[model samples]
Target: MQQLQILSGSWEQFAQDAKLIREQVFIQEQQIAAEDEWDSEDAVSLHFIAYDQGQAIATARLLENNSIGRVAVLKEYRGQGVGRVLMQSIIQLAQQQGRSFVKLSSQVHALPFYASLGFIAEGEEYLDCGIPHMDMRLCF
Candidate 1:
Protein backbone atom coordinates (compact mmCIF):
# COMPACT_ATOMS: atom_id res chain seq x y z
CA MET A 1 0.00 0.00 0.00
CA GLN A 2 1.26 3.46 -0.82
CA GLN A 3 1.19 6.41 1.55
CA LEU A 4 -1.83 8.65 0.96
CA GLN A 5 -1.89 12.37 1.73
CA ILE A 6 -5.42 13.72 2.21
CA LEU A 7 -6.18 17.38 1.76
CA SER A 8 -9.40 19.32 2.37
CA GLY A 9 -10.41 22.80 1.29
CA SER A 10 -12.76 24.73 -0.93
CA TRP A 11 -13.42 23.49 -4.47
CA GLU A 12 -11.17 26.14 -5.95
CA GLN A 13 -8.25 24.81 -3.98
CA PHE A 14 -8.36 21.36 -5.57
CA ALA A 15 -10.83 21.47 -8.45
CA GLN A 16 -8.37 20.17 -11.02
CA ASP A 17 -7.28 17.15 -9.01
CA ALA A 18 -10.77 16.43 -7.69
CA LYS A 19 -12.40 16.68 -11.10
CA LEU A 20 -9.87 14.34 -12.64
CA ILE A 21 -10.72 11.54 -10.24
CA ARG A 22 -14.48 12.17 -10.40
CA GLU A 23 -14.48 12.20 -14.19
CA GLN A 24 -12.67 8.90 -14.29
CA VAL A 25 -14.79 7.14 -11.69
CA PHE A 26 -18.26 8.65 -12.16
CA ILE A 27 -18.32 9.75 -15.79
CA GLN A 28 -15.95 7.45 -17.60
CA GLU A 29 -16.22 4.32 -15.48
CA GLN A 30 -19.79 4.50 -14.20
CA GLN A 31 -21.24 6.02 -17.40
CA ILE A 32 -22.93 8.87 -15.53
CA ALA A 33 -23.74 11.77 -17.81
CA ALA A 34 -21.43 14.80 -17.77
CA GLU A 35 -24.30 17.14 -16.86
CA ASP A 36 -25.33 14.97 -13.94
CA GLU A 37 -21.75 14.63 -12.78
CA TRP A 38 -20.91 18.30 -12.49
CA ASP A 39 -22.95 20.56 -10.23
CA SER A 40 -22.96 24.06 -8.78
CA GLU A 41 -22.79 22.63 -5.25
CA ASP A 42 -19.15 21.87 -5.89
CA ALA A 43 -18.31 25.55 -5.64
CA VAL A 44 -19.87 25.79 -2.18
CA SER A 45 -18.84 22.48 -0.69
CA LEU A 46 -15.70 21.51 1.15
CA HIS A 47 -13.77 19.12 -1.08
CA PHE A 48 -11.42 16.37 0.00
CA ILE A 49 -8.83 14.62 -2.13
CA ALA A 50 -6.40 11.83 -1.42
CA TYR A 51 -3.03 11.87 -3.12
CA ASP A 52 -0.83 8.81 -3.42
CA GLN A 53 2.72 9.65 -4.40
CA GLY A 54 1.43 12.96 -5.75
CA GLN A 55 -1.42 11.51 -7.83
CA ALA A 56 -5.02 12.08 -6.88
CA ILE A 57 -6.55 8.71 -6.09
CA ALA A 58 -9.83 9.57 -4.33
CA THR A 59 -12.15 12.49 -3.75
CA ALA A 60 -15.29 13.46 -1.74
CA ARG A 61 -17.06 16.61 -0.71
CA LEU A 62 -19.06 17.82 2.32
CA LEU A 63 -21.92 20.23 1.73
CA GLU A 64 -23.04 23.06 3.99
CA ASN A 65 -25.94 20.94 5.22
CA ASN A 66 -23.48 18.38 6.56
CA SER A 67 -24.25 16.04 3.70
CA ILE A 68 -21.40 14.23 2.01
CA GLY A 69 -21.35 13.58 -1.73
CA ARG A 70 -19.38 13.16 -4.92
CA VAL A 71 -17.24 10.37 -3.50
CA ALA A 72 -15.06 8.64 -6.06
CA VAL A 73 -11.98 6.48 -5.92
CA LEU A 74 -9.83 5.70 -8.89
CA LYS A 75 -10.17 2.09 -10.08
CA GLU A 76 -6.55 1.34 -9.37
CA TYR A 77 -6.88 2.55 -5.79
CA ARG A 78 -10.33 1.27 -4.83
CA GLY A 79 -9.41 -1.75 -2.71
CA GLN A 80 -6.27 -0.26 -1.23
CA GLY A 81 -7.93 1.55 1.72
CA VAL A 82 -7.62 4.93 0.02
CA GLY A 83 -11.37 5.44 0.17
CA ARG A 84 -11.51 4.47 3.82
CA VAL A 85 -8.81 6.91 4.77
CA LEU A 86 -10.39 9.67 2.73
CA MET A 87 -13.74 9.13 4.47
CA GLN A 88 -12.19 9.01 7.92
CA SER A 89 -10.71 12.42 7.27
CA ILE A 90 -14.09 13.86 6.36
CA ILE A 91 -15.79 12.24 9.35
CA GLN A 92 -13.16 13.63 11.66
CA LEU A 93 -13.58 17.09 10.19
CA ALA A 94 -17.31 16.96 10.75
CA GLN A 95 -16.78 15.96 14.36
CA GLN A 96 -14.39 18.84 14.80
CA GLN A 97 -16.99 21.23 13.44
CA GLY A 98 -19.54 20.11 16.06
CA ARG A 99 -21.94 18.80 13.48
CA SER A 100 -24.96 16.93 14.84
CA PHE A 101 -24.81 14.39 12.05
CA VAL A 102 -23.49 13.83 8.56
CA LYS A 103 -25.72 12.48 5.86
CA LEU A 104 -25.32 11.18 2.32
CA SER A 105 -27.15 9.59 -0.57
CA SER A 106 -25.07 6.45 -0.96
CA GLN A 107 -25.16 4.17 -3.94
CA VAL A 108 -26.98 0.97 -2.99
CA HIS A 109 -24.02 -1.24 -3.81
CA ALA A 110 -21.76 0.80 -1.59
CA LEU A 111 -24.08 0.61 1.42
CA PRO A 112 -21.91 -1.95 3.17
CA PHE A 113 -18.86 0.25 2.85
CA TYR A 114 -20.60 3.24 4.43
CA ALA A 115 -22.24 1.08 7.07
CA SER A 116 -18.83 -0.13 8.16
CA LEU A 117 -18.04 3.51 8.76
CA GLY A 118 -21.07 3.88 11.11
CA PHE A 119 -23.59 5.28 8.64
CA ILE A 120 -27.14 3.99 8.99
CA ALA A 121 -29.43 3.62 6.01
CA GLU A 122 -32.86 5.24 6.15
CA GLY A 123 -35.88 5.20 3.84
CA GLU A 124 -36.38 3.22 0.66
CA GLU A 125 -33.86 3.07 -2.13
CA TYR A 126 -34.39 5.59 -4.90
CA LEU A 127 -32.87 6.32 -8.27
CA ASP A 128 -30.44 9.13 -8.70
CA CYS A 129 -28.81 9.59 -12.07
CA GLY A 130 -30.33 6.23 -12.92
CA ILE A 131 -28.43 4.49 -10.11
CA PRO A 132 -30.10 3.06 -7.02
CA HIS A 133 -29.22 4.91 -3.83
CA MET A 134 -30.30 5.15 -0.20
CA ASP A 135 -30.20 7.94 2.28
CA MET A 136 -27.71 7.35 5.10
CA ARG A 137 -26.49 9.24 8.09
CA LEU A 138 -23.96 9.10 10.92
CA CYS A 139 -24.79 10.99 14.05
CA PHE A 140 -22.10 12.59 16.11
Candidate 2:
Protein backbone atom coordinates (compact mmCIF):
# COMPACT_ATOMS: atom_id res chain seq x y z
CA MET A 1 0.00 0.00 0.00
CA GLN A 2 1.22 3.50 -0.73
CA GLN A 3 1.85 5.90 2.10
CA LEU A 4 -0.66 8.71 2.41
CA GLN A 5 0.32 12.39 2.48
CA ILE A 6 -1.85 15.09 4.03
CA LEU A 7 -1.96 18.75 3.14
CA SER A 8 -3.69 21.72 4.74
CA GLY A 9 -5.05 24.62 2.75
CA SER A 10 -7.36 27.56 2.88
CA TRP A 11 -10.56 27.03 0.97
CA GLU A 12 -9.58 29.70 -1.48
CA GLN A 13 -6.46 27.70 -2.32
CA PHE A 14 -7.13 24.00 -1.81
CA ALA A 15 -5.25 21.44 -3.86
CA GLN A 16 -6.47 19.16 -6.60
CA ASP A 17 -6.81 16.31 -4.10
CA ALA A 18 -9.20 18.30 -1.91
CA LYS A 19 -11.39 19.16 -4.86
CA LEU A 20 -11.37 15.58 -6.12
CA ILE A 21 -12.48 14.07 -2.81
CA ARG A 22 -15.28 16.62 -2.39
CA GLU A 23 -16.52 15.94 -5.91
CA GLN A 24 -16.53 12.20 -5.48
CA VAL A 25 -17.75 11.84 -1.91
CA PHE A 26 -20.13 14.77 -1.51
CA ILE A 27 -21.40 15.36 -4.99
CA GLN A 28 -21.40 12.16 -7.01
CA GLU A 29 -21.76 9.30 -4.55
CA GLN A 30 -23.60 10.66 -1.52
CA GLN A 31 -25.79 13.17 -3.34
CA ILE A 32 -25.54 15.35 -0.23
CA ALA A 33 -28.12 17.85 -1.42
CA ALA A 34 -26.19 20.58 -3.15
CA GLU A 35 -27.67 23.20 -0.83
CA ASP A 36 -26.45 21.48 2.33
CA GLU A 37 -23.06 20.65 0.89
CA TRP A 38 -22.06 24.23 0.25
CA ASP A 39 -22.39 27.53 2.02
CA SER A 40 -20.84 30.97 2.33
CA GLU A 41 -18.88 29.74 5.34
CA ASP A 42 -16.40 27.89 3.11
CA ALA A 43 -14.88 31.19 2.15
CA VAL A 44 -13.17 31.32 5.53
CA SER A 45 -12.66 27.68 6.36
CA LEU A 46 -9.62 25.42 6.38
CA HIS A 47 -9.57 22.30 4.22
CA PHE A 48 -7.44 19.20 4.41
CA ILE A 49 -6.91 16.27 2.09
CA ALA A 50 -5.17 12.92 2.30
CA TYR A 51 -3.47 11.70 -0.83
CA ASP A 52 -2.04 8.28 -1.55
CA GLN A 53 0.48 8.53 -4.34
CA GLY A 54 -1.14 11.75 -5.45
CA GLN A 55 -4.68 10.32 -5.41
CA ALA A 56 -7.15 11.85 -3.00
CA ILE A 57 -8.28 9.33 -0.40
CA ALA A 58 -9.77 11.46 2.37
CA THR A 59 -10.88 15.01 3.07
CA ALA A 60 -12.40 17.30 5.73
CA ARG A 61 -12.99 20.97 6.39
CA LEU A 62 -12.73 22.87 9.66
CA LEU A 63 -14.30 26.27 9.96
CA GLU A 64 -13.38 29.02 12.37
CA ASN A 65 -15.11 28.35 15.74
CA ASN A 66 -14.12 24.71 15.19
CA SER A 67 -17.12 23.44 13.26
CA ILE A 68 -16.05 20.43 11.20
CA GLY A 69 -17.88 19.15 8.15
CA ARG A 70 -17.69 17.39 4.84
CA VAL A 71 -15.47 14.69 6.28
CA ALA A 72 -15.13 11.79 3.87
CA VAL A 73 -12.88 8.97 2.73
CA LEU A 74 -13.26 7.24 -0.57
CA LYS A 75 -15.28 4.01 -0.20
CA GLU A 76 -12.25 1.92 -1.10
CA TYR A 77 -10.20 3.64 1.58
CA ARG A 78 -12.73 3.80 4.36
CA GLY A 79 -11.88 1.90 7.59
CA GLN A 80 -8.17 2.02 6.82
CA GLY A 81 -7.42 4.74 9.44
CA VAL A 82 -7.39 7.40 6.77
CA GLY A 83 -10.42 9.12 8.26
CA ARG A 84 -8.92 8.94 11.73
CA VAL A 85 -5.72 10.57 10.64
CA LEU A 86 -7.58 13.26 8.78
CA MET A 87 -9.80 14.03 11.76
CA GLN A 88 -6.87 14.11 14.14
CA SER A 89 -5.11 16.57 11.91
CA ILE A 90 -8.13 18.81 11.79
CA ILE A 91 -8.54 18.59 15.55
CA GLN A 92 -4.93 19.53 16.05
CA LEU A 93 -5.34 22.46 13.74
CA ALA A 94 -8.27 23.60 15.80
CA GLN A 95 -6.31 23.43 19.01
CA GLN A 96 -3.32 25.19 17.57
CA GLN A 97 -5.60 28.03 16.68
CA GLY A 98 -6.62 28.22 20.36
CA ARG A 99 -10.01 26.69 19.76
CA SER A 100 -11.47 24.65 22.62
CA PHE A 101 -14.24 22.74 20.86
CA VAL A 102 -15.07 21.03 17.63
CA LYS A 103 -18.49 20.07 16.38
CA LEU A 104 -19.90 18.10 13.48
CA SER A 105 -23.12 16.65 12.12
CA SER A 106 -22.48 12.98 11.40
CA GLN A 107 -24.59 10.56 9.43
CA VAL A 108 -26.41 8.00 11.59
CA HIS A 109 -24.45 5.13 10.08
CA ALA A 110 -21.24 6.83 11.13
CA LEU A 111 -22.18 7.73 14.70
CA PRO A 112 -20.10 4.92 16.13
CA PHE A 113 -17.10 5.95 14.10
CA TYR A 114 -17.09 9.50 15.46
CA ALA A 115 -18.05 8.36 18.93
CA SER A 116 -14.91 6.27 19.08
CA LEU A 117 -12.95 9.39 18.32
CA GLY A 118 -14.48 11.29 21.27
CA PHE A 119 -17.31 13.07 19.50
CA ILE A 120 -20.44 12.90 21.60
CA ALA A 121 -23.90 12.87 20.13
CA GLU A 122 -25.68 15.96 21.37
CA GLY A 123 -29.01 15.99 19.60
CA GLU A 124 -31.76 13.85 18.19
CA GLU A 125 -31.36 12.35 14.73
CA TYR A 126 -32.75 14.22 11.77
CA LEU A 127 -32.93 13.65 8.03
CA ASP A 128 -30.12 14.92 5.89
CA CYS A 129 -29.78 14.03 2.26
CA GLY A 130 -32.39 11.35 2.84
CA ILE A 131 -30.25 9.80 5.59
CA PRO A 132 -30.39 10.22 9.34
CA HIS A 133 -27.86 12.47 11.07
CA MET A 134 -27.08 13.87 14.51
CA ASP A 135 -25.25 16.81 15.96
CA MET A 136 -22.01 15.88 17.69
CA ARG A 137 -19.33 17.65 19.63
CA LEU A 138 -15.87 17.23 21.13
CA CYS A 139 -14.48 19.76 23.53
CA PHE A 140 -11.00 20.18 24.90
- lDDT by residue (42-138, candidate 2, tens digit) is 7787888888898878888888767898898998998788998889888887888888899999999899989998999996999877879999999
lDDT of each: 0.94, 0.85
Q: Clashes in model 2: which pairs?
A: none
Error of 1 at 97 (Å): 0.7
Candidate 2 wrong stretches, greater than 4 Å: none
TM-score for each predicted model, relative to the true structure: 0.98, 0.90
In the range 80-112, model 1's lDDT, one tens digit per residue, is 888899999999999999999999999999999
Query: Judged by TM-score, which candidate is best?
Result: 1
Predicted structure 1: lDDT? 0.94
RMSD of each: 0.7, 1.6
